[model samples]
Target: GITLSGGQRQRLAIARALAVDPRILILDDATASVDATTEARIRLGLREAMKGRTTLIIAHRLSTIALADEIVVLDDGRIAARGTHDDLLETSVVYRDIYEHGLLERQFADAVEARGGRQPLEAAS
Candidate 1:
């Protein structure tokens, strides 16, 4: 039996999805299991792979959907705002909260890494 870690499973799932060549791609926190560095690399690949296709990415990590054509902020299961990243930052409190928290988390993780300490939450293996 083979046991795959969360990150491995995520990568495998992404690969399978890409292999299908679908017209519309829906990715729900596709890079959540990976670390920041790995997520950046995967984002680059995703950018290329997503070209010429409509991609709907549901991610709490702002970086994951930073380049989206349009962003929709949802609060309490309802759409609170809709716009680009910069736009939402100005008009959407929910989006700002999410962005600010993610920024703080990244900064904290970087500080820990710099001090030769592990992140509070380990990236999925």
Candidate 2:
């Protein structure tokens, strides 16, 4: 039996989806399993592949949907806000919270990496 890591499986799934060339693509946290670097590459490829298609991306990571034509922020299964990223950041508390949290996580990860993967004591507490 062959075993694939989560990132590998995600990339495979994305490839399969793109191969079908569907009129619409629904990606739910599609890049969640991959590291930021791999996710960036996938995003670039997806942008090219999705140029003529309608894409519905449900993602908590702001980077995943950064290039979207429209962003619909959902809160508690309801549409809380709808707009571009900047617009939501200004007008939607839900969107701002998500974005800020994600940003902080990335910053923390970066700090850990900068310190050779040593998490700060404060972070561990």
Q: Give the best candidate by TM-score.
A: 2
For candidate 1, give the lDDT: 0.91
lDDT of 1 by residue, 21-125 (tens): 999999999998999888999999999999999999999889999898999888999999999999999988899999999999888988888867966566856
Counted clashes in each candidate structure: 0, 0
What is model 1's C-alpha RMSD?
4.7
Give the local distance difference test score of model 2.
0.91
Report the poorest 10 consecutive residues by lDDT, candidate 2. Answer: 116-125
Cα lDDT listed for each candidate: 0.91, 0.91
User: For every model shown, what is its TM-score relative to the native structure?
Assistant: 0.91, 0.94
- Regions of candidate 1 where Cα sits further than 4 Å from its true position: 118-125
- lDDT tens digits, residues 1-125, model 2? 99999999999999999899999999989999999999999999999988989999989889999778999988899999999989999999999999999999999999888888898555653
